[model samples]
Target: MSPRVKGAVLGLSAAALFGLSAPVAKLLLPSSTPLVLASLLYLGGGLGLAGLEALRRLRGSGASGREARLGRKDVPLLLGVILCGGVLGPVLMLVGLQRLSGVTSSLLLNLEGPFTILLALLVFGEHLGRAGALAAGFVMAGTAVLGFQEGELHGDVLGVLSIAGACLAWAVDNNLTQRLSLKDPLALVRTKALGSGVCTLVLAWLTGQPFPAAQVLGGALVLGFASYGLSIVLDAYALRLLGAAREAAYFATAPFVGALVAVPLLGERLRPLDLLAGALMAAGVVLLLRERHGHMHTHAALEHEHLHVHDAHHPHAHPPGTDPTEPHSHPHRHEPVTHEHPHVSDLHHRHKH
Candidate 1:
């Protein structure tokens, strides 16, 4: 399949899985404090992915040499991802969820897309076209409408700020993860989940948060495995293929999914403003999805390793006895070339517009 198609599928799938998290988490909240629940959620995702990794290794299906492995140089970025995404993001989200309706909280999550895109463009050297800029504006406008209702903000102001803060933290995490997208995604996410999970778990214990009941714990773990674990792996792959800004555009759909699910699951009413916000955000995502960018660009010669098939980008000849029919990774060189094709800000296509 085409890289863009695969990236869109991955991003959408990630959205569906993660979209269920907010409402379900709200239902689980009554039984556990935000800190303790956040810890369990991360621990669940980490442990679940770890088991899958172990199973893959046992079955000899591991990508031992088929994908690039993270190295010392990736440590700082990985740490940033864990700190922002796994720890700060989840904690703040849960705290906000406590004081807000599930649907509103879900809709409010639309902010993450704009925040991520802004970071991608301004700080991470990614580019955005006219459609992308308009899409961002629409999304921000939707958030503003939801944020200020009936001539004032809805729900608790503190809760709104907390969720926005979570979005910002995850925005930073998204960009950092994009930088590390060249590594084995499963391995990268596993390390991130486990590391952040442990840190949050420690913080929960220190704060005297009680452990949840067995049933609640189990539910949380399962949810985390699907939402945080698998969803994250898919998102990492999308980032590699589509760049952070485009991936965020697709992922922005997640909040709408969550909002819709919340109406039935949480018995929440969809106020007119909620519907209005949803319409605006949905329009923005549609624009982003329809947008395309392609131009004549140059690729600098470089050496790197990542899972790849010998295609337009990698026309280099391999050594004798190398497996030629499957995607594999090793240190390789790219001879400089200039060409024109439709592309986003992927690793190879980061040239200035």
Candidate 2:
């Protein structure tokens, strides 16, 4: 399959894995302390990915330079991202999970998408046109309905606040990661896992949390590897192939998936209103994906047409100055004839048919 298709599949799979974490974690909570669970989960994810990177390095004889190295210049931003996304984000989420009901937590978690989109627009100058605005509205409205239906409005304000903070931190991480040029995806994930995991473990110890049992530790390890390590790698790949906006659209489906999974796993009941809201959310996602695919198709077609016409007209140019690989020059310009002269003099050319 094409890279784009592979990316979308990976992204959707990551969403599915993330969706499973909520309910599975709810089960594991009874058997394990939250801080210990959080520490082990993150540590496992970090170590698992690090191991994979080490194996790759050994097999390739250290020739794979795609791994990103953390430089002093990247220290501050990296620390901030890890502090917010890696350390604070999961801790808040785990705390919220312990206090809030599964359904309530899932609904509240939907806040991440809008927070991300708003941050992208305001901070990164990422455009969200009329269609994107409509998509955002649908998602927000659906989430609000779900939240109200779940009786999250009656829950502890502090718990809600904690989850909200987690969402915001994730939003910041998503945008900030986009700014850095990390050649090695594995290295980036490893760095985030190690930094965030270590910080969380330190904080947990400082807070006087008890150590986990062997079974609890084992569960946490599995959870961390799947939810943190693999899911993030898939998410990064998806973002790289599909761009942030489109990947965010796909990622928005996770809450709904979580809600669905909760029914069997957590014994959560869905009301009629919940079903309606879910349908609306699904519709919004479908519309956004279709719109993105259409846009990509048109862009690729335009580029193909332009290149085809340029090549047909400049068939005999030398490999250097007038090479077809170079951009076409202005047709109206007066210049002496040489191999370097404009071959396809159509700088302002428009492709037709």
Candidate 3:
């Protein structure tokens, strides 16, 4: 399959994996697992990834070099990402899930996409045109409707607050992950998983939750590996092939998937509004995908080679004795430019001459 198709599939798989977590947690909640104890599931997932990565390295199939090593400069940022996404996000989400209906939490969790988009725009200067704005609005409205139907407006305000906190923390983690210079994809996943898992496990132990039964602990380990570890790997691979916007657009399907899975797995029922919200979410995704076709530009950066054919009528001068630069001139032409910074090397620039 093509890279784009692979990316889309990977993204969808990541969403499905994430969607399963809610129902799985609902099943395990009967064990009276404290939120902190549940958080260890995430930690277990992280450690599982770390172990797999280590095994992969041992087998000579893992990423290597400086990119694979955590440096002093990355420590603070790594800690913060772990704290927010690893420690706080899951803890709050588990607690909220315990109190809220699985379906309700699934729908409310849809807020992550819009929140992520807004944060990307405001904090990272990512472009959000009118189309993106409209998409965001659609998602926001759908989430609000779901929230109202879920009775968050009249329910425990603190539970709502906790879920909101999880959303924000995940948003922060997403943006921070994008900003980091880490290039070894597996290493990045390992770092996130291990770092977050360690911190969360420590907190869980401190909270005095009883050790899970061997069977439950084994289940949690498997869930952690699939939901956290493999899902992240799939997501990273998808993001590498599909730009964040496209990957996120596809990933946005997670909430509906979660709701659907909950119906069968957790025996939860969805109301008409839930279906309506799902429709809106699907529409929003269609809009996001459609935007890609509407806007097509060749984005080239300095220090990279780009080849394009220009027609004869383009009216640009070529080097002496070379073919004239035209609208449809050469079958292929090469252009290369240099930039000072590695990150800026891929930045797009328009040619004047």
Candidate 4:
């Protein structure tokens, strides 16, 4: 399959899995405060991914899990993504959930799409064509649709602000994560999970949050594995294959996933606004699927370490008998070349338009 197609699928899958976490977590809230549960969720994700990494080594698979191991130079940026996305985002989101209903919180999380796209366009220099712009508009419109009746006149002001703040933090995290997208995604996932999980778990203790019951701990771990660990690994792949804006656009459907599931879980009545927002979010995703970015670009000679195969883009020589078709990692240099072809803002295609 095309890289973009694979990327979109991964992004959508991640978003869908994340949608399930909110309501299930709400069910577990009686066991502990939002802070402690948030910490446990992250801890679960970290430990789960770490175990997966261990299993990969034990089975001696392609080791794609370690294909693009983290390096010295990657430490600071990796930490940044962990702190912004893994630590701050989930904590603030749970805080908002404290005040808002589970379904409402899930729907409100739609804001992350537009926030991610806007940051991608303005800060990361990602190109946004007509389709992308329309998608962004629909997503932005959806964000407002839920707000009109969120808490009636009084409004859940603190809850909304907290969730919005978390969205912004994740938006920044998504853009920054582009820098590491080309690395081993599983490695990245485990690292972020461990880093954020450990940090938040410690913070929970320091802040005097008590440990939750076993069932609640289990829920947090399970949710964290699916929502944070696996979801984020997929997200990293999407960022690598598709540009941030398009991935964000596709991911906008996450709210719909949550809303649909919550109808039964939360016994949520289908509101008119819910239908309207779902339509808009769906339209946005469809438009993004049609997006295509291709143009003549130059590749400046550079060396980097990441898993790569001998595609037209990889014009470097390797030692005798090395299979070019098999993906491998090395500090290969790209000779300057100019050509026209379809591409996203992937590792080799981060050129200014």
Candidate 5:
């Protein structure tokens, strides 16, 4: 499949997995504190992925040579990702889930998409075309519509603000993660999940949060494995292919998936405004999916290592023994060339528009 199509599949799949977590997490909330639940979720995903990695290596099925390793230079960015996306984002989301209905909380989570896109454009040097810009606006407008809680100001306000905070934290995570998307996705996400999980678990203990029941603990771990662990790995691949701005547009569908599950699983009734918000967000997603971008751009001489096949941007020589049939990673250099083709803000396409 083409890179763009593959990226969309990975992104939408990640969204579905993550979207299922909200309502189910809400169900698990009564049995566990937010801190503890968040801890297990991360730990679950981390350990689960770790085990899979170990198993892959044991079977000699590992693709380590096909992916780049994280270097010391990546430490700071990885740390920030763990803190914002792994720790702060989940805790705040759970806290907000406590105050709001599952469906509302799910819909409000749409803010993360617009937040990530804004950060990509404003702070991270990514550009969006007109349709993409209008799509983001529609998403934000839908989020605003969901934020209006008819008559319950005091209760809903905190929930809205808390989720918004979570969105901002995750937006930072998304952009930073895109910067590190060239590294091995499994290793990157595992490190993030494990580090953040341990830190949050320690904090939970210090705060006197009790251990949840055995069953609840198991459930949280399993949920984390699927939602947090596998979902993030998929998202990293999407980021590598699509760039942060476009990936955010695809990932934004997550809230809709969650909202749909919430109504049935949580037995929640959707208000008319909720339906309207869904329509707006859906329209935005459709626009994003159909959007196309291409132009004349220059690729300056550069050196980097990442998994790739010999495409237009990568027509470099390789060692005698290197396989040319499949994607592989090694130190490589690019000669200066100017050309035009459809592209997003991927690693090779970050040139100013």
Candidate 6:
């Protein structure tokens, strides 16, 4: 299938898994302190990814096929992403959770999509049509209604600001991740998990939060593995194919997914508001899926490393004995060309706005 379709699937998968993490985390909150729990969760993810990578290594796939490797230039971007998404954003959200109800916090978390879209369009030049805007409005309205806990900010200005700040930071992180999407998704997730995981653990220790029991820590790691490691890897791959704006639109459904999972796990009663939020999210995704944008655009001569099949955009020849039918990665060159096709502003489609 095309990259756009692939991206949507990956994005949805990522959202679903990430949504699962919340209620499960709630179950574990009593077992550990905030920073310590967050650290363990990410530690599990990082270590899990590392093990997966080790398994892949045992398969003897060198650093030359179907994935790009990180270079010296990627350190800053990787570090920035780790700081924003892994550390600061989660910390802020955890703080907000302390002040707000679970339902309220979940609803407010939907703001990340809008924040991401705003940054993507204004700063990153990702496209969004009129329908897209209305869809976003609908979803936001639904979340806003659900979040109406008597009044805005749940009567606490600082709490609202904290959640809003977390959303913005994550938005920035999402956009930044798109920048490095051409690299190996596994490596990307691993770096973010490890850096942020270790950093948060240090912070927790410094703050005198003692480590939890080994079983609790192990459970946190398992939670991290499924929810974060696998989920983030899928997200990275999706961002590579979908671009920041579209991916964020799809990922915005996480709150609804979380609510769905919470129904059984948390024994939370599903209300009309939950259904309403789901409906709104579904409408938004439908609009995005129906969007079709195509134009004749020029491609500058460029050199890059990414997994690509010998499609229209990738017309370069493969080496002897290599399969041209499948996607593979290598440093390659693209001579200037102009073509028209339905597309999102993905890595290769970063044309002029």
lDDT, residue 74, candidate 1: 90
Return the top candidate by lDDT.
Answer: 5
Q: How many residue pairs clash in each candidate?
A: 0, 1, 12, 0, 0, 0
> Rank by TM-score, descending?
6, 4, 5, 1, 2, 3
TM-score of 2: 0.71
TM-scores, all models, native as reference? 0.87, 0.71, 0.70, 0.88, 0.88, 0.90
Ranking by lDDT: 5, 1, 6, 4, 2, 3
lDDT by residue (247-269, candidate 1, tens digit) is 88777667667777889999987
lDDT by residue (1-353, candidate 2, tens digit) is 65445655776787777767767877876665666666677777889898887788677633233333445766777778788877778788877877788777767877787887787667665555577568657766766676665344446888899889899998888766654423355666778878888888887888787776677678877888888788877777666555555456667666667778889888998888878778877777655544432121111111111112233333433345543424433122222222222111011211121
* Alpha-carbon RMSD of each model: 3.3, 9.5, 9.0, 3.0, 3.2, 2.8
Error of 5 at 96 (Å): 8.3
Clashes of 4: 0
Model 4 lDDT tens row, 153-265:
32388988888888988888888888788788888878877887787777778878889777768878988998878887888789888878877776666656777788889
Model 2, runs deviating above 4 Å: 1-7, 31-34, 61-72, 90-107, 150-152, 155-163, 266-270, 292-353
Worst 10 residues of 3 by lDDT: 342-351
Q: What lDDT score belongs to each candidate, Candidate 1 first?
A: 0.82, 0.64, 0.62, 0.78, 0.83, 0.81
User: How well is each residue in 1-353 modelled by candidate 3, as lDDT tens digits?
Assistant: 75556766787799889778767866865564555444556666677877876776678641232123445666777777788778888788877876766556655666676666667666654554577567656656655555455334333667777777788888777766654423455666778877777777777678776676777777777787878878877886665555454556667666667778889898889889878878887777666544432232333422211222353212234566753332122222233333332111011322121
* Candidate 5 worst ten-residue window by lDDT: 146-155
In candidate 5, stretches whose alpha carbon ends up further than 4 angstroms from where it belongs are 60-65, 87-110, 146-148, 155-166, 320-325
Residue 320 miss distance in model 6 (angstroms):
8.7
TM-score: which candidate is best? 6
